[model samples]
Target: MNYKVDPGLYALGHPDADSPVFISANFKMSFDHLRTSLNDGRSGWILVLDTDGINVWCAAGKGTFGTEELAKRIESSGLAGVVKHRTVIVPQLGAPGVSAREVQKRSGFKVVYGPVRAADLPDFLDAGMKAAPGMRIKTFETGERMSLVPVEIVHAVKNLVWVLPFVILLSGFSGRGAFLSHALQFGSVSVIGLLTAIAAGCVITPMLLPWLPGRAFSLKGVWPGIVCAALFLFVRDVLWGLHPAGALETFAWVLVIPAVSAYLAMNFTGCSTFTSLSGVKKEMKWAVPAQIAAVALGAVLWVTSIFV
Candidate 1:
């Protein structure tokens, strides 16, 4: 969805020249949330910077919410005329890309980082823009993580499309009956197993992140992925009254499912509030190579399962 507003200054509830100015991305949801949260009883001037329809945290990480964008927006929005104060409140999460000192030097307006959540804006502004200790602390509460599930699912499903054709071709070779007779059935089961593995990583792992055993999402995701793979095999055995493929097929599942799940789980680091940019980079260095190795080996195993 293209949720974006024109990049400029917006007045919330008849904001006057003396009203506080808040900096935010042009994503409509981010803009709406900030305005709605602050609309309780106070008036404010909102300076929306173009982040190409992305949320503040992501845009900030992507550099769209950097010093240049904020400085340019401040100038283009005519914020000087709209607000009397020289300081603008920026979201705390946006600090990674934006240098407060640089913004000040360029825009001649001081940047003050506000609370992490927009809901805390009322208290923050009411207290003369002094953020409480709790406001500065970043949190990824259950609801916030849950809200991200849909987008993750969509991204994962897009990548899974490539697996479909491979799945159909591979499973057909492993089937016992005439190729055409069992290809569809075997392909269907493989797809189910693949999707289950993905869900175990994308949905189950993220939902139970706090309780999951490991700090590394890849490790945490592997456990559920293994369980999902096992269950798929068990279900096929029980329903079809036949051994699903052979040792090679089981070996392939052992590698592929967890590998896929680990990869999907790793993607969550980008969405997390706790993981540092440098930490994510370091983790990816080792984790990506391992995941690639496992996936490549598993694909080879699956292809060879029919002949060997």
Candidate 2:
């Protein structure tokens, strides 16, 4: 099958009267994984609910994966006319947004809550299964932690471009050394620092999420960022030998790196099962201003070091 992970209704081979009907969110990755997991020659109907490109859980919380959307999509896809069964299996995490009673009332189709992970779908279908306690639970495993990095990197790069030129310009103003060399050096350091920051937020923090000593993602990210910055400084001093103005540059980065990384990690609240809107809002109120201050202060110090 030449299956592409599109965000719409797709029939996986020829679904028969006994074939199962699966529902998933419109997010490409989610849809793709669902289909890929079912590649063992099972025929089914995949009805993708439009969740505005968000995964099932987040979209469910936002009500994008609610009863109304499901009802509408079922009607538009002509699913009622095509399928012999009136049962649709939905991801368990989407339970918050969808009211099974309401969906049944509106569309005459009963909603069955499926396993938490897509990989369990085949077993789930074969056993004529109810959601096991394990299947109903969500866990952020190492693989899940790693997958978030690509999107975070993409977002960070866009922001980095805007900040890079200014960092380079400031490097020249910071010293009487060869301006071009200093600028280039500054750019390199800035990129390294930013990439480190992204890794701290998107990779390390999430992998160590349970072990990270904080209730907030910002705080969770800060621990790794600070550790990463300290290790970077130690290595730089030992290997490259610090320049006369290197201490100031290092100090600025220690503060700046963690702040940026923490802020970015905080954004991952949307992806997490632990975060609530009220909790995220509260964290942002404190974390955002603190990050801005740290970045501003770091910039000021770096510029001042040039004059001194």
Candidate 3:
């Protein structure tokens, strides 16, 4: 049980002749959650189709969760020999990629669409039914909304390290006191600015997705960045002791913070429920150039502030 199974066939809790067979993506998180959701109680066969570490929705979109992979995995796993039933229950989100008829033709097994979430598998099996509307529909509730933050934070940290040395170097060139003190202050401001942008793009905007007033992810991320920049400028200049330069520096940051965050957030389109490939391509056409301009402007202003 502790060993890593190949991303094909897994037997959970010793399934018998009558046990149900479930199909899921090969992504570690998907497999782990599915097994955990069973809680050592269910007797079933889990057919993990190779999705190349991608979750169901994305894999489905990219055709990794297609009929061919499903059929191949089923045949190679020798699943037909283990189970009496010729049925495999698949996640509803994967329906777009898989042709059930083709899978049945190729693999000799009928495919049944299951509930949207792995947690609902037990009840779904107990009921012995097809997916209901609620089971098929994707929902981004509070709990689901919170889970995406860690990945975003990790990516941010990795990228932040690359930019940190430059920030320190710039801060050191800014003033005459202890280099460490100035570096620390600059680092703090930069981190605050980065985290604020992340919160705006990844957390707040997504949570308020419907009300964010944008069709594209860039626009969605931009609104939050604008609000966060306003608040940040207010707190840093009005309340805190820091003094930013003229309107240029202020305007530059207002553009820069959100632009970077928006670019990062736009990358999430591949993982989101609403984003399409065509849409993301279109948004990137405009978003990428805008981001570059904003960052360049901010860098220029920051450098100018030291001299003037």
RMSD, one per candidate, in order? 2.3, 3.2, 3.1
Better of 1 and 3 by lDDT: 1
Model 2, residue 167: distance off in Å is 1.5
Question: Model 1: runs farther than 4 Å from truth?
Answer: none
Candidate numbers, best lDDT first, in rank order: 1, 2, 3
Candidate 3 per-residue lDDT over residues 172-267, each given as its tens digit: 655577878777776567567767777777777667766777788878888888899888877776554666636766776687778877876686
- Show the colliding residue pairs in model 2: 174-306
**Per-residue lDDT tens digits of candidate 1, residues 202-282?**
988888888888888788788888888888778877776656558887888888888888889899987777887787788
Question: How many backbone clashes does every candidate have?
Answer: 0, 1, 0
Q: What's the residue-level lDDT of 56 in candidate 3?
A: 84
Q: List TM-score per model, in order.
A: 0.90, 0.85, 0.84
Off by over 4 Å in 3: 1-4, 38-42, 175-191, 238-240
* Most accurate candidate by lDDT: 1
**Model 3: number of clashes?**
0
| Cα lDDT computed for each candidate against the true fold | 0.85, 0.81, 0.78
Q: Which ten residues in a row have the lowest lDDT in candidate 2?
A: 1-10
Instruction: Assess candidate 1 and give its lDDT.
Output: 0.85
Clashing pairs in 3: none
